[model samples]
Target: MNNNVKASINAVIVSAVFGAVQVANAAFIEDSKLTLGMRNFYYDNDNREGGADQREWAQSFKLDYSSGFTEGFIGFGVDMQSLVGIHLDGGKGYHPDSNTFTPSDSDGSATQEWSSFGATAKARISQTEFRVGNTLTPSLPILIATDSRLQPQTFGGAMFTSKEIDNLMITGGQLERAKGRASTNSTGLSVPGGTEESNHFRFAGADWKVTKDLMLQFYYANLEDFYTQHFFGLIHIQPLGERQSFKTDLRYFKSSSDGKNGEPGYRFNNNGGYAKNPGEVDNTTAIAMFTYTFQSHSLMVGHQRVSDDGSLVWLSQANVVNGSGRNEGEGGISFYSFTDAMIGNFARAGENTTFGQYTYDFADAGISGLKASISYLRGEDIKAVSGSGPDLHEVETDLRIDYVVPEGPLKGFGTTLRHGVYRGGGTSIDDQDQTRLIFNYTYSFF
Candidate 1:
């Protein structure tokens, strides 16, 4: 079918799914078994040099309902979500600023507002459960569902999770589409900014508890053409006597071309965009991070290195199907912000990085629900010419204090602040500084 025809069909499908959700709520969801939640965010992003700045306010509403059980060991339930966004400080020039939202007009800018919502049907039998529709599935290499906004991103597909085996939990899923935080239009997931041709995606994984404080995970995902990745993770916690614990997290990723750009994709070729890039390659990466916690304080450190290739290919942004998409997110494997997320930002070609971080929990200090953290990521010997570049150096610092009102109508409101700077590379315009301030409040009703 033609591009326009396909787009029209996709839109129709979306409407039908949405309509089905509403019908289910009215006909099947029991009022007495209903639960509701809402989250509101006030966000601001400022850029000093360019005329580009962002200000936005958003609210997300979630509804959950289930009928106790169908008079047997088998039970059924449904999950629903409704999201909305309001334009606070963004305009036309900030077209890309709309990210997950709608694109700009002919003048090249962002739209004022947008929103999307979805629902799912689920069944449970013992320790195994299955669900279909909008849900968060962080199944390692396959899908890293992000939650960096007022509402978390979700995948439109079906998933099965079970813990029937002793000390072992198994998961697998087939996701056909995904919904970003800013937009309600679900799109077929591509690599970075890839095509939406292929609608079939699969993943399977297992997590096992080796001991009281030790766990291991294995996952594999085939993202058709863009790349196929395998992930291995180990987490261990060692108590340093009473009131102290040392945490260790280790991860390994191996990825290569799949499908078209992959050995399977019909479009696979050596003359493609990925083939010409210097550092693009089928390679692996390993990371080891450790944390020490003591009396409301913690310190963390880690090291990461790219394998033989000049540039990291599989990790670059691209269309999962077209293999020539965009990296809308931060790009690269960033180590700056939180030690947990390695999202946004990209490492220069042939680069190796070292990072460290520290966090303080102020609850014991009588500041309940308040905490602060900071981290640094440094990468040197980046590619410049033919696997050579002007090396990369970046630093990011963030401070946030949240106070959930102990007694008030807005008892769960809080605030946050973030700042960061990056330098080096030849992908886009040189280096830049970024900052964000957010005030948020969330509540739930059952």
Candidate 2:
């Protein structure tokens, strides 16, 4: 880690210890909770074409500590998170020298191990809470942290949330930097093809429950010199019978160019797809999803359409290099859309995607703690990068199974297996098949 990060962590530790001792209250000590989480992951990818395959296995440990608020009208507390990852196996030629899964050594090989540490200080008053920290993980409609890898990505920022009104929640925040999942350092925010970094990311949103089964959402976000985005969402559920229900979800996004966007070094790649105005952000996306549940089965279907002007935009630091002129493995992002699939994101320009999923809960069949799901997505009418050619196409299918040990010595232990197959034509993405197996367990201490 760098000197700045080390100093921040040390200061947090000192403050946490001193504050707890000074308070000397039951709420601060007796209600504190700590948990240790472990995950073992194995990943494999096979390229159908003559490309390099990626296979890696690793184990990660996370220590999370949360302290209860002190006794006061304005309660105060602290939270800390520590993570460590160890590479178990990734033979030569199998582990690519990319920050996608693991940090790379100077020799272009996987690093043996990596670790990170962060802390947050928070205060609560009435129905509102304010927090400032380097471990913020926001799940707003405009920006969502990525946690698909061994470590969850984190942001350094300050935020506030208010729930003073019944059935209403308001949230806003400003994030300055982000820590990549596979690296120990933090970097500024940018987009997929942006080389220059921007430290300002501001967002505000509200969720209002209009009725017992209907909710509405609206949010706005801006990334300095990158893009400004607005989001709207609606969700409704209708009960059909004792064991059956239907859900409807709708989402829409509008994005446009921000300050200095389309300039050299701050260009948007349009997700490597077509762009009406090269390097400029101008797009709108609409999505609708419906789900029906009956007994032990659930089915979901969705459709998404991207504007013909540009691809969708989101906050990313993938292309930003650290001071050492090397990537810090900060390359994964999650958008609040169903098109953000396991193997591919179907958010290219002028693209139309149709997708569906089927899931089963084995508990209804006397097999508790077991579940399975399969999904498929096809994207067509994708404009080529040149903006004047035959439309491109891509498809992906994913299968997943999950199980947890229940009512046994290994209770709470969980296992997951996932496989995805992707095929594409006339796009930069290649055909590939990927699989992942993961084991997770956590123990708590109070």
Candidate 3:
């Protein structure tokens, strides 16, 4: 973290402590909650075509504390989190540059250990709350924090959420920096092919529940010097029978170039595609999904479409956006989309993806703590808008199973297994397979 950022966070912490003490209310301490979580993760990836396999094993500790508000017209609270990762395995050549489970060293190797600390100071008035500092996961469709790795991603920013009106939520935020999932340092924001770092990311959105079964959403986000994006969404659920239901989800995003997009250090290649308006952002992406559920079984089908003019845009600090080669750890990012799957995002220019999944709960068969799911995504008819070479295609399959202890001393313990297979040509690697095993346990102290 930078010195100025550190100082600002410390100042906020001190102010929050002082405010709590001055309020003379025990609610801040009486309603506080603390949790100690442990995660053991093992990741293995194999290139079916060639190259060495990538494998890494690590143990992570997460300490989280959340305090209730102090008494008053405006209540004050604080939230703190500390994450530590200790490497258990991953010998020489096991840690690939793209692997984000462990921190990368100066020599492109995995470090033995890494850690980070963050805190959020918050105030609440009525149904609205304002917060500043590190928020682990943001509930925004334009940006998402990846938690698939050992340590989840976090952003340093100030955000406000208002739920004063019934069935309506208003959210807006300004984000300046982000700490990657594996890195201890924070960096500015940019897209995949953007070389310039834009510290300012602004977004505002609202969600309105029109009825008990339908909701509408509209959001706008701008990444300075990168792109401006707008999102529109609709979700509806219908009950068919006593044990049957159906759901519909529709999402759309339109993005255009912002300031300095075509200038030096701000140029984008559209993720190596032929951008119709070179260095300028212009794209539209849409996805629709329908699901049917009956008792213990659920099935879904979805399709995603990307405009030919340019690729989709989201904020990511990866690829050394500022043209600095010193920070390689900030290479992992996640976007808010259904296609952000286990193996691939399937979000290239001109790509049309069709996918499906089937999930089942083993409780129907007397196994109360087990669930399994499998999904497949196929993308085709992809071509550059500038009339580049041949059209591209890709395919991915994923399988996942989770188990949680039902009771006894290990009630909060859980185990998850995931496997994925990816195959493609342009913009994607050759044939590849990946597997992950995770064990997690959390204990809470009030």
lDDT of 2: 0.92
Index of the highest-lDDT prediction: 2
Q: Quote each prediction's TM-score.
A: 0.77, 0.94, 0.92
Ranking by lDDT: 2, 3, 1
Q: TM-score: which is higher, 2 or 3? A: 2
Model 2 stretches with alpha carbons more than 4 Å out: 1-24, 323-325
Where does candidate 2 have its weakest 10-residue lDDT segment? 317-326
Those runs of model 1 whose alpha carbons end farther than 4 Å from true positions after fitting are 1-71, 91-109, 136-142, 262-281, 310-344, 406-409, 425-430
**Over the stretch 161-272, how does candidate 3's per-residue lDDT look in tens digits?**
9999999999999998888887887877888766568888999999999999999999999999888999999999999998899999999999999998877778766766
- What CA root-mean-square deviation does each model show from the true structure? 11.3, 8.2, 8.1
Error of 2 at 173 (Å): 0.9
Question: How far in Å is the alpha carbon of 262 misplaced in model 3?
Answer: 3.0
lDDT of 2 by residue, 46-81 (tens): 988879899999999999998888767888899999
Please give the lDDT score for candidate 1. Answer: 0.58
What C-alpha lDDT values do all the predictions have?
Answer: 0.58, 0.92, 0.86
For this target, which candidate reaches the highest TM-score against the unseen true structure? 2
